[model samples]
Target chain A: MQTHSYTSRRELETYHFHPMVAALVPLAFLLLQAFLPKIFPRLLILDLPLVAVIFFAVARRSPIAGTITGTVIGLLQDALTHQPIGVNGIAKAIIGYAASSIGVQVDVENLTTRILMNFVLSWVQSLLLFLIFRYLLGLRDTHLVWLHELVRASLNTAVAIPVFLLLDRVKLRE
Target chain B: MESFFSRFKNQLVLIVILLVQTIALAVQVRRPVEPGHPDAESVRLLRYWASSLMTPAERISTGFGHSVRGGWSSYVGLRNVRAENEALKKQIAEMRLQQAAISEDALEGQRLQKLLDFREHYVASTIAAQVIGTSGSEQSRMLTLNKGYEDGLKTDMAVITPDGIVGKLRLVFPHSSELLLVNDPTSGAGVILESTRIRAILHGSANGRVQITNLTQDSRIKPGEKVITSGGDQVFPRGLAVGVIESIVPDPEHQPYTLITLKPAANLFQLEEVLVITGTQPNLPGDAQQQLAADAEKHAADVSAERLPSIHDGPATEADPSKPTDETAPPANNSTDLVPKPKPALHPDRYSPGTAAPAAELTPGSPRPATDAPAVEPVRKTPVAPETPKEP
Candidate 1:
């Protein structure tokens, strides 16, 4: 297998999704994120919305598109929760921008690269959430249990493997 | 300038988006949209739009799953129906005898309440709702119910299961309402220990555990004591089961208070159907029941004095009433020297007939009652003896 290094903007490959696929895929993931935990609570560790955000951001490889997608998805996720409607928005926005920028430079199609990117980005998202809640929101009671968060990041990474593969079938290379 | 903007448009867009969301978050934190408060239109609209977009799919999915599970269980999972039926029948026979004894006790309680001219609220009506979805994050333990404002669900309405109190309605939409579960870090309720009658505030922790707060370290709280709603918060009805105390340890953060862990009475995680209390009626026995009271008193007199304690006998007063008595006071443990005093009972005048005060008149600690209906009146207004002082 050969890995392509997209050092220039012209060499970078981008993917576009159909309008319906773009709208429904994240919506389905959001529904599953909110609905499935009712049956299997351990699934709470799997951040389906975050996985979807990362997938779209990396696949599209456009910082602007990724930013907007992340903002919309994160805000929707926040709206579902009782917390203030922008905590996840800020975290996912940054992650989206970063993931897409990374995608533009590196071979994100490689399985090992995708897994490592997801694992590291999950931690980044978790840290952003912690800072937003603690310092920005002034919620002193907000704390992070390292072990729980580690398991969460790992779970999201593991689930992202299958999710990325499935989402790959829907994208149209541009 | 245009060329400069084009040179780094993505960075500029990201900055603008982050700044906007940060500002929105700051505004929300500054003025949180509490239930029933209509000040924050933008935040409310954002949430409403999100709910509108998501709830239809959730309802359909939940309904389908329930239908499939119900069909399977009803048709295929009936291996021991005969043995279960016989066991239930035997249990019913035993419960009948127990019910008779409890009825007598209830009658006696009614008589005493009448003698004291005490009035209390009873659940008058409830709306059954199905849980459709959750917040999906551990930090916010909110459940979405199928019933909404259109179904007469107002914010702060107490939601309960058959087992115990679940939570209260936090946000109500046109088609669905959000339930702030008892274990959310921001949630709290007034609870009392059954054995000790010690009232304390139940708080949910970030770790999804329920714990009793505002309790002094010296309070003699032990494991396994049942916790019940104290009706002090005015959201939950009095006497509803809340939880059981699981453990008590000294609070490392607050020096004077002990961290008492609680095991919730309801299996909150596994709830499917819940009842939202819509209305409450006042229970007041009247003078026409004087004959009934006399009969109850005579029945009480027939029972051996040793078996039943007289209602007239209040706590044993010490020579110096201010000093803590060994039997009546909470024991001072090795952790602390100060014993927390019991909270005073709510003044009867607050709920007296015809007052019909607005929600603002309620104490700050109590959640405002949802409706503005007139204060309930007794069958007949008759003066009676003072209320029996409760045990400390």
Candidate 2:
């Protein structure tokens, strides 16, 4: 595992992305996330924006760029909802920064790593939303449905594997 | 100092971004956009920007999808067409029968209302809007309509379908608007159980289920009983179908009220189009009201004589105390004769439209009113005055 991590890290040091791809990919994911649910309601369980954020952050491998990208994408996602814009923004920003920082040390390109990353990040997002809602906004409307969320996390991971593979082609590598 | 600043710059950026968002959230929560207020206009402007950017794409996509689906269904889906058409015909026949019965009842209700001088409010004009998109989040349940301020839609206007109410228009943009669905956690409506007519507040839960709250535990509400808008909220018109009670359970909080789950009459999840009520008019009395009044007058004229005090056929002011009480009886002087006068036929002019004469004057022996006297002939036989016996 250590040897594999060193090799992927060395590869990451050389990896880079086109700026337009960085911008448009996240926007496309946001649009799809918003649009697909209207066609098939069951698709509501999949958080495509979060998947895009994780993919971008890990691919960029720069904490600062990942944080900024997450913030912009999160706010855009917020714009599509009726919720307070910042809740998703804050959560995604944290996820983006952490994923990129960890990406520097691990091989998130592995399918298993990608799934585990999404699974853990989904819970983290929900927890942060709960805290912000309870402490900052004094809202109690969102309940912690552990089982539903677990299923949602697994679905997000499953979707991420294929979506990331498609996105990888569009990504420009050094 | 320079090394320290460089080292913490990324962390500082994250902190700054988070702080800015936090403030934005706080500001939004502090003065949330409400319908009709000028302060809320700012929020509408923001929504307008967002919707203008998004809804055009949505419309194009939906239109394209519909065309594609339509083409496929028209040619490739012909196998069940005949069976479906026959089923639809049968359904139409059944609905026509129901419509006839309902129209009869509505006529009767209108007649009764007119008799009591009751006024009603009815939808005067409405604009049809297509459901283009949703709020795209579970936290807020809302839909976007294809009509907006240009279409004369304002905030707080009622939106409904033939089956039931959808919701109220919340935010209006130039070309589109947002509707807060009735099942959102923040939504509440004054609803009445159709069976018992007991009123309660219909509240939306976070899980997208709606329930009746504030009904006393003793209230007998049956499952499958319909719920309707009470017009108490002044948002939806009264008597519009809302939903049906699905179940009644004790309040989990041990409160005095029971909780009732409801199945919405409108297919909230599958809405395609809705009617936005633009204006309402006061319902004026129709022919039904006039017919009711005429019938009442006729009834009163028929029974007036039996209900009034009897008087001799003379001027109403000058009463003869010795006169027999019954209109048919002859004068008292004819005690030996004991013969009664012939009863008069009912006068045709006795009861005219809008005129209700005093009951005593309507009797057979009484002279008709001067205006009607020329048209009425006295039909009763005047008894012959008893021949004087004084000479004998």
Candidate 3:
């Protein structure tokens, strides 16, 4: 066996990857969400990055990876753009941790089981987001608060079934 | 130990966010043209950099939307070509008649203004890009212009058109910029009356209309008076075509000041191309504000008189109390002599051309004190009796 200098990073002979890629995965979805709408205009949907984050959280047995990724992506969004700094990072981290906690208790074998868990996750996320927007953001009588919840919940729930089944092709377990 | 680092890191993030947001709010809530504080540059830079990527994309989308709108307008124009042409011909005829009255020498004076050399006053140092898109959120209004630092555009440049003022630059980036439309409440432009030469503080009323507030009620501002900048505000050079004062309403509730309603000569919804002015010199237009009022008076007469109440310069008295306010003075006149004697005119604006008939029925100002002026006190006591006699 070759002696390794780095403990955190390793070359994979099979398909197992480091957790950072798992974190950066949502970045692709985010860029796609922002870009696709401009091109097609009508296909613009909601909660792409968040949905991806939740999916990875449940798929990855280790909750630590999702939480770390969420924090990184959140900070990246804040730095790259003009938003309240750290706000996104905090929200994403919390989301990641929550998703992973739920994931830890669930059975990974059944396809329908994953979909139901995703549906429950979407509803809980939507509700939490609405409260955060209303109180923390002070968006009273704001359409965005209700809109974020309703639109994201429905869209993620619909999108969740397909994504979970497809990712099921590759097992992500110890 | 495990929880401590995580908690501390989270706290640090919160602190940083709070610090940045406070700075942004402070920078934005300030007067234009005043060179911003040191922190403002960073905020501007941050906003520009953050929005830069989406700016071009936005501009393209906005441009496409505008093009679609323009296409729609042209389609509408084509549909109504016959009637529109007839109206245009009528307007052309009016112009021709006006031309015949004014000397060719005078017409040349207006058209010959070297000040109008758009190239010099505003060095059209354009970055040669188009508007990509526009997006507005509930928190703020913004326009995504494709030109930015790459186009040599900076923050606080004045934006206008051949028609008049539109807005000023708020946020800029490497590839895009944002514009503030004239109707935001926070948006202010210092303007001068084309008439009395008095300066009025113009504010956007959040809706399309603009409010020129805190002007003294006694200001000789009249309807249809033109308003322009007085070369004082550094943000907008003096004498740009800001807007026309459509109506001047005295705020009875405000006590001591009047709020004038300003309508921008340029319709933002109808803009295809615009001129961005860089010059700081404000030149007074030898404009015919007096003439506009005369023409508008005729237009006003054609409109039904009742609509004037809303457009009436100043807030309407909202009291509408049930209690009477001393108009109950009874006429001691012989039933045959209820006619009121004519008095001098109260206000010219209050008297319309249709006043010819009403002018006959009641004299302006004095109806010869209605003969019952002294007896009005007794009439108040016997309100029922006055009606009984009038019924007789």
Candidate 4:
């Protein structure tokens, strides 16, 4: 496997998590994303599955693995919804790939970097969905409330701060 | 070619995967399965897999929660049981008397229905299901129920609570299904004002609030007027409680249409268990007499919210039909709660001797009739009750 050498700022070591953690984390996120809203509907603003996709993608630093993870998780999220599948899958795939590719060069370990990445990626994902629903699908009512999106992004990023830290503890080091 | 593939393998894989998914989406959109029909095979399989993975965990957790609450209520608490039991007995006695009159009115209404050859659908059966999860996005307002294909749940089946209609079942898996809530922007319902009878199209806004549109400026609706399903959408049975009108404003974009906001009857966010209406059968003249007896028996059997008389189906005449009990009485003030108040009996003069006039014509600020008004009006007016046929 050929990995891109984007930078030499620091020695980069590959970390491989236990395969079960890799599988279970995403599954748990998907389940909670689907389940928590039933108990506290306001929690919908936090997209945990998207957060997990970003965390795993950055931690693994493998664009291929990240893209695949995004695809599966996104599809699973779509399956839980009534919308036509793949809208989320495509958006998450791009986010996963971008985060991982960025991971390869930039250091995502800094809390500031992690927060900024999640905030930017959340907007990107929302914009992608808004565009798909509006132009591609010709859905008339699909309009993005910029303020709501901004607030949601902030909330997701805030959640990602702690979530990424917790998830990091579960990762197996090289 | 090998060198090129190796250099951009990750990008190439991501593009390929996205393209495949896009194609699938295109296929689904192009051949959009009609609502209420089974989804496309692949989507159905995907849903089955997703539900199979998640619903078990949800069921276990929900069951555990229920057990704890039930245990607390049963063994750990009984202080108010005596007071509650005595109050319920009194309520039941009062309902028995009202039940007798409602039964009579139901029979007369059925005879009128048969006379007019009125073919209408009523909820024939329902399966109780626990709400286990949701779509987790306010944009996609959906609930996941624990009952599914194995439980005879089907797409487009009306889901409800004792308070009002919730939504329709959008998809069914083996052990779980998705409820497309009425608050979803994509959802639309035909609804009418309880007293005004002004029909309009109700659609969910982006923020999960329901509003009525497609109303002509000539339509007269008030803020506190109760909204009920008009049954024109063919999804919900006519006369089911929907919501209370919150406000009405002219739609600036659509010249002739007014925008009326509503507060839904059931607490959507607080849902735990709901009924999935499985089937509906039309009322026929042959079954009308038999249905009358069955209606009485059904009303007798279940003395809970299911049997409560609809406030929308006010007595045909303004004469107090029965003693106003807390359960049956409309609130003293409509603005007291967010839940739609039970409608009081319409003024006797609203429907004139021969022709019915629009309820908006009633004199504004005219004092409402006292609850203890005479209860002996002849059963001349056709009752608006739909709850009788819903039993089963």
lDDT for position B371 in model 3: 31
Pitting candidate 1 against candidate 4, the one with the higher lDDT is 1
Worst 10 residues of 4 chain B by lDDT: B348-357
Tens-digit lDDT track of model 1 for B107-152: 8787688899977677878999999998888878988899899999
Write model 3 residue lDDT over B1-392, tens digit each, in one string: 87886866544544454455444434444425454222256555655554664454555556677689899999988999999899999999998778545534333444466556532122233233343433322123234556665667777777777677777776666666666666555467878888798887887653346787778776477888888876466676666788787887777657677878877888754444555554433232324435544545554564534543333433463334695654433323334434444444444222323333444567667643333112223345654645422210
DockQ of all predictions against the true structure, Cα-based: 0.62, 0.54, 0.06, 0.56
Give the per-residue lDDT of model 2 (tens digit) for A1-174. 455565566464535667787777776676677667677766767788898888888887878878987888787776666666677889899989988877887777788888899899877887787788778888755678899878888888889899989988876676
Q: Return the TM-score for chain B, candidate 4.
A: 0.68
Report the lDDT tens digits of candidate 2 across residue range B1-392.
99987999878888888899898878878994544652344444555666777788878877887899889998876988999999999999999767655655665777888899966667777899988887766666788888999999998899999999888887788788888888887778888777788888887877778877787776467888999988788888778899998998988765776888999999887777899988866662455446555655554554443433232323553446795466764444314455665555453333443244666567787655555433433444778655432211
Candidate 3: what lDDT? 0.56
Candidates by TM-score, descending order: 1, 2, 4, 3
**By how many angstroms RMSD does model 1 differ from the true structure?**
18.1
- lDDT winner: 1
On the 0 to 100 scale, the lDDT of residue B5 in model 2 is 75
Q: Candidate 3: lDDT of B325?
A: 50
Q: Candidate 4: give its CA RMSD in angstroms.
A: 18.6
Worst 10 residues of 3 chain A by lDDT: A6-15
Which candidate number has the best DockQ?
Answer: 1
Model 1, docking class: medium
